[model samples]
Target chain A: MAEAPTNPVALAAESTVATRMSAPPSFDVADFPVPTGREEEWRFTPLERLRGLHDGSAAATAGGSVKAEVTTPEGSGVTVETVSRDDARVGKAGTPVDRVAAQAFSAVEKATVITVPAEAVLTEPVRVSVHGEGGVTFGHTVFRIGAFAEVVLVLDHTGDTVRAANVDFVVGDGAKVTVVSVQDWADTAVHCSQHNALVGRDATFKSVVVTFGGDVVRIHPRVTYAGPGGEAELYGLYFTDGGQHQEHRLLVDHSAPNCRSNVAYKGALQGADAHAVWIGDVVIQAAATGTDTYELNRNLVLTDGARVDSVPNLEIETGEIAGAGHASATGRFEDEQLFYLMARGIPEEEARRLVVRGFFAELIQQIGVPDVEERLIAKLTAELERSIA
Target chain B: MATLEIRDLHVSVEAEGGPTEILRGVDLTVKQGETHAIMGPNGSGKSTLAYSLAGHPKYTVTGGTVTLDGEDVLEMSVDERARAGVFLAMQYPVEVPGVSVSNFLRTSATAVRGEAPKLRTWVKEVKEAMARLEMDPAFAERNVNEGFSGGEKKRHEILQLELLKPKIAILDETDSGLDIDALRIVSEGVNRVRANGESGTLLITHYTRILRYINPDHVHVFAGGRIVESGGPELADKLEAEGYEAYTKGGGVS
Candidate 1:
């Protein structure tokens, strides 16, 4: 099926499916259609790369395949269930009706089901690790937290091998879940991951995604509020150096009353021809009264050749909310603050590091888990050191 | 011995149409362990002298030089001047957000001393100093000068003075915006420093209140950007009774 053109009408329809990103795993194109470049929402994103998956690239073959592991990690409150790969991948033979339809259904058909027990409070996080030593490998992982259960999940994407992977997530009602996903892949790896989360009424969900290094990376995190009084917090930080292209697309929906959502993402891009894009959108329906939503996206362009494109969008059907605001800025370091620090006897480079470290310190401290916080700081500092050279 | 010699110093700031000179040929010398008071009117440029001495990026010094212990203070960078033992207890200290008072003080002390102090000893000393100033020790954990009341910020400035122990300190209007109680605590902190007998102080103020407690040996009246009259501690008492109008009416460019 051909994709719709980018326009207001098609954008409206795409917005609907984009809003339902957190729905249960189902590979039915009729349910969730692939948004075309013609839609205003998909304008800057290169859909052509997504189409690359169909041309025998993302196909799953039984021979010479690689397997990924998902382990429950310490300090993360959830657990993972082991599922067979053959049961998860359902596609066979040649082309299907719709490309999106074939991809979604095929993955959902063979998804490994990890369900959180009701009222179960998990203290250790559920860890997911993916390792591929050969050609590109594609897989889908799904998580469902049972009602009234509280759990913390940590997704660790790792591989000594080079390949591509896709992962998805879903969160349940009256349940509070926190997910911290750290992507520290091999320098030569190509990573393409997608995360979908559905939040139920009075349920709170928080996700933090950090990417250290990747060749060509793309992450799509789609969250939808299914029940009233739901809340979601999303944070992402990515560092791309030496011709790396990292892009993260986020969608947050306020579908019912008393819903709240917040997003804050920061990135530092360095070296020649390195590019990073952060696309964020928030939707407030007419019924989402007393709804509060806010988003902030900041990019630090450290070099002349490096570039960052950021977009913060608000789609409000009616303005009957407590508060709604969006802010975005892409720029270099601040001079006055630097001068103040320099005046205090700190060198220029040390001052820059302090300001940048302080800029992200609040989020680092808020990570709740000490080990994860330390790991993140070490990785981020290593990237900073690379940028200095 | 370390000495801060202000030799025929001339300073000015931008005014209506041209430069309005604040200090005109003002000459003063502060040797180690000596305290001098610069008493003047609100616009008499006492703060200008302190700011100029501290190497504030603003406050142009058109003539003369400031030398500390035989080294040219004017040529030194802000941090360099600081590390060289020149501390300014700013009248309006900046509120640096996202930086805790302890962190900032430790960084400043480390830079000034060129090495980290013993953590246990430093903490104990900081606690003792805070107690002397009647400051809550919790203030040290808070961000530097952020959300502090007028008296609290001033006392914090004194806390830095107690910790850094610079060779020469220029107190610019530290007495202003302070209450009688805060003034007493600040004066006591100054006395403790003087007790060391190894540091010099240049106290700049418009009132004789702090002088009554600090007990400076020399008091000079700054008029039209120059010292029109100089005397002992009695000069501060004289100014308190008579006011600066007499000096303003009689003085010309000197």
Candidate 2:
């Protein structure tokens, strides 16, 4: 209950890490034991459904399963290269903290490094499209932005495959980076990924994760400030249908002075056995003074059989911070909203669609991409039509 | 002419312990072009009659028969009742966040009129109506009742009444929290629709203030969940002078 200490006096405190993470960050995959369904981090996950990605039994059986392509505009001073895992840029942002991420790091055959030089502002977005041809794949990608640079990066996934990937972002001082990762895989696909961001002094980092399809998906994004005055924002949106499991776990480590972090994630679930899990952890260390942070998660359950588990954990070790807070809410379709719409001569089905669309309107606007927004709106309509049918 | 007939209407709402009957064996009739005011005190079930007619799911009809021009109103669903020309201007309109007023009105108009309204004319009509209500053009972009003050909520309800054009309009305490200016504007909106002689107005209120603007053909004193006395427009003045203390003392459905 005691959070957000404002003054810088001698306040007795102890800096700490989240107890949910049983192991510390390490580069070696052997350091982490294979997760069962019982560990704190894996409690809500259906470990058996991860297609052997958790226990290291799954292999790259299908060769052409996933094809990766990166597009950069002409003379943009951006370089994209496919290098071996020994590349100097590999793991520059952060190391793997869990089994799936560590496994991807140790087994990745090649790493893709995209570099945006200092002070170069991009006029067009750098687009990466990962097309799943079939089977299984492992990948690692590093994005390093130079100081005072600005860029909008979009990564899109499609088709069917079993994948485990590690994506790292190294943001330079005073740089502004916006990353949008869309997990729109086929219903038969399985995906587990770890995203790491090392934000520099006075830099701004924003990442938007959207998950719409897949039998199972678990995404872990960790953030650590490298210098003072940095800011990080993590946003996520998911829509879970019947027999699907989607999970997002995030940790924002405010390690430097005057750094700020904000996180928000929203989800809607329908059909029987649909499950959504959101775990947000914010830790303000003892030396990180003047830190301001807040996190929120809201879930709208559309049907009876769907379930949602939302947890917001805030741990402030020092009593000399500026502000810290978190909130989580899970509610069903509001009967009052439904009745209000119905009484306006709108049918039940149309009224439902309107309410659901309105619920996601704010988050969808954050994408800032016209074509992507239009596509999401169309996808939302299609998702609603399934229930109506 | 459209007519709404309510006979032996009994309604109950779920409470802490169990179902508690609110409207007990009430009878009333409202006809097109007629404004009937049902005056009562705090717990006399005035709002119950409005919600029951509007087919709200919260209030259950234990025993009743409601008919609009000889069609069974109770048999229809909420939206069906609206399409059949029944409307209730709720005291506390529900907040629908992110649903802009323009979008809500257009959708409602499309549903009631069975087709989308012509854009140019519809925009003109809405703009003019909002002007008459002294509402700013920017209000159309605000979400429905999301952060509206009391007066704004009442005005929005009346705006819907003007646009939807239901044959049977039930104004439940529409003047409860309005200032004099708002009361006058809302009253004029109701009168404009009434002048068409195509809809009946059932105005339920605890105070006689709004009746001064919108004259009622009949004034009914309600107590014990039923109407105990009926008279002409002068009855409103009489009740306004003496108040409903005499009628509600030992007169409620205890």
Candidate 3:
């Protein structure tokens, strides 16, 4: 059961959470103090709009307003369980890196664990849908895959509420997994989440994060390899409309030898006050010999008064790595492309639509889900019509 | 029969300082089923003429009146010009990422035809057009003009020319950056369209090599942004034998 504070103001007055820290990040809420928009990690984030998730001012009440439903494929040898916070497998995948994530870890009483057996291949995708019924909620979910297991997981968020959650993914040796997380909340909702993935030896992990709705949404996805020969691919696509704030922060750590990582994220912003931010970070340690990594971010401003901030950072301690590079570009629709399309007899409005559809087509096809791809295309078309209208 | 009439055309393009004149008081006309070859040296404003007729935004028409079958040509928008039966085969076709050639051709056809083509016949039409261009069938699925070789791009332009079937077609340097084989193939496509006897062709080029393939009904030697000489087909042979130096002396129009 989840809880909500009756008087938010009183809770804020009683809370004495530290607002500064000079040490490394830890899972404990007290260890990593609440951010006051001064820290490097929290500089871009709007502290006041967090709904008190950062500080312990928003106490939990037994409301259970957010409901989560998990559906596994039939005969896939998958099991789902609800365990206490003290469960041994709770924090094996990753530890929290920020105060909000730490607070989420301390708030959720029961954590959901979904496990796939070793050497099992799922023919159908597993789906987890979380629907918000109002109020505030905190959640934690863990996905554990055994050695050589192959699975596709789809996590969907919807409805209107304030939410702070943490999701952990643990991939065993030689396992292959694809996770598609979509944030399609109501226009009045606010969501903050941190996703951590740990790839085992020779394992392959692919994560696709698609954000389309929500008032203020921030998602952080981080990856780290436990052994050599592991490969990770991170892809993201987001659309921000008027008065919406969407942020994506990603990190890939290559600590083991011969590991590889590639990241590409693209976003389109429209209308006034639409802001989209992307931060890509790749760190290659001294022991990460033969490490190869590349990151790219592109933003398309569809209309006036929209802003995008794209930052790509790479740190290499060893020159022995294979390769490391990054690129960032932000622009509006190219006039040349518009002219080319129009010179062929397509009307101005239709040509504009086609150009934008083409911009997102490449990434949409990479999703590999036919139904989901079609839905996204339809959504994008509707969004384009709204912008024009 | 359709007639494209140009009267004292004057065009200029914006530069760092101000508006720089490109086409200065030029006049040309083409009747249906006629191929008019405009040959000139570099910087002779030959391409500017082609672009001006197609109504490019970069080239401003300061003083000009172009009429296509008695309709104002300069007043129409870029796509409106295309729908009104005016086509331009650009020298450097732009690349449109994520848009397949098949989709682009169909969309263009739909806009010009005012309705979607029948699925069964449209597929056959595309297949036949690609085959006639000697293009591999896989190219239809590739992005429009993306990573296409120079020859392939020219062939693609021809493919559109054959499909769109506009009343007036302006080929701007269509022969440049092409090998002998590609030149022959592209020329044959143009010849096929000319054989229809329903569209007028305005071919702008720097060399007379392509004239050997597609014999023009009229030849115009352009110098100093205006036509210096106009004659029959033999004028091309004379110009090819003797370069434009005879027409251009002391950088003055003869």
Q: DockQ of each candidate's interface versus the true one? A: 0.24, 0.76, 0.75
Candidate 1 chain B: worst 10 consecutive residues by lDDT? B245-254
TM-score of chain B of each: 0.96, 0.97, 0.98
After superposing candidate 2 on the true structure, give the runs of residues whose Cα lies further than 4 Å from its correct spot.
A1-17, A60-64, B249-254
Candidates, ranked, lDDT: 2, 3, 1
Candidate 3 iRMSD in angstroms: 0.7
Supply the global lDDT for candidate 3: 0.86
Expressed as tens digits, the lDDT of each residue in A300-341 for candidate 2 is 999999999998878777888989999999989998988888
lDDT of each: 0.72, 0.87, 0.86
Per-residue alpha-carbon lDDT of candidate 2 for residues B83-186, written as tens digits (9 for 90 to 100) = 89898899989988768999999999999989999999999999999998889899999988999999999989999998999999999999999999999999
- Model 3 C-alpha lDDT per residue in residues A140-238, reported as the tens digit of each score: 999998889999899999997788889988888899988999998998788888888888889989998989888889998888887889899899989
Clashing pairs in 2: A65-A133, A65-A134
Give the interface RMSD values of the models in order: 2.8, 0.8, 0.7
Query: Given the true complex, what DockQ would model 2 score?
Result: 0.76
* TM-score (all chains, Cα) for each model: 0.76, 0.94, 0.92
- Restricting to chain A, the TM-score for each candidate equals 0.81, 0.93, 0.91
> Number of clashing residue pairs in every model?
12, 2, 4
Ranking by DockQ: 2, 3, 1
